[model samples]
Target: MKITVIGTGYVGLVAGACFADIGNEVWCVDVDQTKIDKLKQGIIPIYEKGLEPIVNKNFQEGRLHFSTNLLDGFDQSQFIFIAVGTPSNPDGSVDLKYVYAVAEEIAKNLKDYKLIINKSTVPVGTGKQLRDFIDQKIKERGINVDFDIVSNPEFLREGNAIEDFMNPDRVIIGTESIRAKEQMNELYSGLFKDAEPRIIFMDVRSAEVTKYASNSMLATKISFINEISNLCEKVDANVEMVRLGVGADKRIGYSFISPGIGYGGSCFPKDVKAIINTGNEYGYDMKLLKAVELINETQKAHLFDKIQNYFDNKKDGLKGKTIAIWGLAFKPETDDMRESPSQVIIRKLVEGGTKIKAHDPEAQNEAKRLFKDIETSIEYFDDNYECLKDCDALALLTEWNIYKQPNFQLIKKHLKNPIIFDGRNQYRPSEMKEMGFDYFSIGR
Candidate 1:
């Protein structure tokens, strides 16, 4: 099968590489010449675990190709995937200009029958809209060609995109055409060697809403747990214990209930807002999701407030204090900083004149780019322990693999004061107290 994935972003690159790894000839097309050049030279733009090696191997093996010209990909591929960015607009609506542009370009170049699959998270009815637009465009050009649009939203996690793609729990295909369904089944069947995938066939609108609804459900769980974590703190209870006790139930699993500062990434925040925007546009209000969004916003600063209240002094008292941050990215194993809570926390700390020393295994450079305006008050470090040197206390933000069981003795030795602020609740409270360090964790 010859597949073309447009836009070499996170979704585009990962999907293209994984498809090629499965023996399909794939072309990863992007308008940015520099990005395509870098991809051709084995330079990956994103820091997803296990992504670079597969991309390099597949590229070297002549299965994966990167190009700036969409014509190159469009002319030779049987299946075209629109993996471009559909970012949020100012009013929280989906800004789908990129997806529309790609669809229009495909319409203009529709020389024969092609199965157009949309892998980007989009609003409901978008597939129908694109189908109509393409039909009109092709008719205006006096070309009597046929193309079937299918909604195939991606559910790949950032850190585990490759694994999720290769072994997805289920794949959703949205098209009424039996031929289109068969085409999609054949393409995705390569992912499973000996077993059939759990492919859910549904209407186009349902498939589009599934992507947003899935993220919104996870967002609700995150906000619900954070809200409960706050109440646990007030009632002198531990959220970790509550989570363990509650998660034991068969119905409610402990998937997205980890109480942290908040959920932040490219997906959760954007999808929640986009769904709410979609509801409002149709004269419907998603009240629960609205509260979920609000709670997530409040939770982002929950740890910062704890750090400030420990001193119980005015902002002037924090003017000269230096704090060490263990993580800067939203989560671990990725360098994405879009809407990271570290941004809100560090911005507040800097506004109060607090200096910060931050360390993240992969996000330090991204942190540098994100916090460049306030770089004077912040220092970047490669070693997590080295980041704690001469700081007032250590504030652990993202729960990276290495930051789990750190050397508390070294932490105490490095910090000017034996204090720690753990947002992820990585350590036990009793253990921290026994270790002779003042430790603060979320809801425990």
Candidate 2:
């Protein structure tokens, strides 16, 4: 199969590389000439685990290609995937300019029957709109060409994207065209051969809504647990124990239940807002989702408030204090800092006249870029221990594996006060108290 994936961002690059790895000839198209040139030279633009090696291998094996010209592989490609970004607007609506632009380009270059798959996360009814848009463009061009639109939204997690792409929990195919469905089945047959068939066939609108609903549900879980954690704090109860009791039920498996600052990434925050906006657009208010969004926003500031209270207890405010941030990325094993809690915490601390030293295994450079305006107030360090030197307290933001179990002695020796704020609840309160250090954690 010959496949062309437009927009070489996270989704496009991963999908293209994985398809090529499965023996399909894939061409990744992007308008940016510099990005295309870098891809040709085996330079990956993003950090996804196990992606670079597979992309390089596929490119070297002649199964993968990158180009700036969208028409370069259109004639030969049987399937073209629009995997562009649909970032959120100020009102939380999705900006579909890129997706629509790609559709127009494909319509102009369509030479044969092709399956146009919407691999980007989009609003419901986008497939129908895209089909109509392309048909209108073709009519104006006085060309008769057939194309089927399929909504095949991606479910790849950032840190584990390659694994998710290769071994997805389920593959969704949303199209009414039997011809398009047949091609999609054949294309994915090799990947799903060993596992039980998990391909879900649904209507286009249902498929589009599934992506947003899935993220929104997960975000709700995070907010639910955060709310519980807040109550636990007020009632003098431990959230860890409550979580254990609640999660012990087989019906409620423990995932995304850990109380943290909040959920942050490209997906959760954006998808929740998008879904809420979608509901409002249809004259139905998503009251539960609105509360979920509010809780997450409040949770992002929870850790900063904890820090301020800790200093206030000592009769020395956060002013002139230096705090060490152990993690800058939203989560571990990826350098994505979009909507990271560390940004919220650090920004508030800086505004309060507090200094920061932050470190992350992969996100230090990204942290520098994100916090460039406050360069004078914050420092980036490669070593976590170095970040703690002379700091008032250590605020563990992202739960990186390296920061899980460190030299507590070294942390105690370096910090001016032996205090730790564990946003992710990575440390046990009893253990921290036994170690003779003041410990603060989320709901425990």
- Tens digits of per-residue lDDT for model 2 on 159-276? 9999999999998889998998888888888686954378888899999999999999999999999999999999999999999999999898799899999999888999999999
Tens digit per residue, CA lDDT, model 1, 356-425: 9999999888888888899899998888898999999789999998999999999989999898999999
Candidate 2 whole-model C-alpha lDDT, 0 to 1: 0.93
Best candidate per lDDT, number? 2
TM-score of 2: 0.98
Residues forming the 10-long window of minimal summed lDDT in candidate 1: 310-319
Clashes of each: 0, 0
Clashing pairs in 2: none
What TM-score does model 1 achieve against the real structure?
A: 0.98
**Each prediction's TM-score against the native?**
0.98, 0.98
Question: Per-residue lDDT for 245 in model 2?
Answer: 97
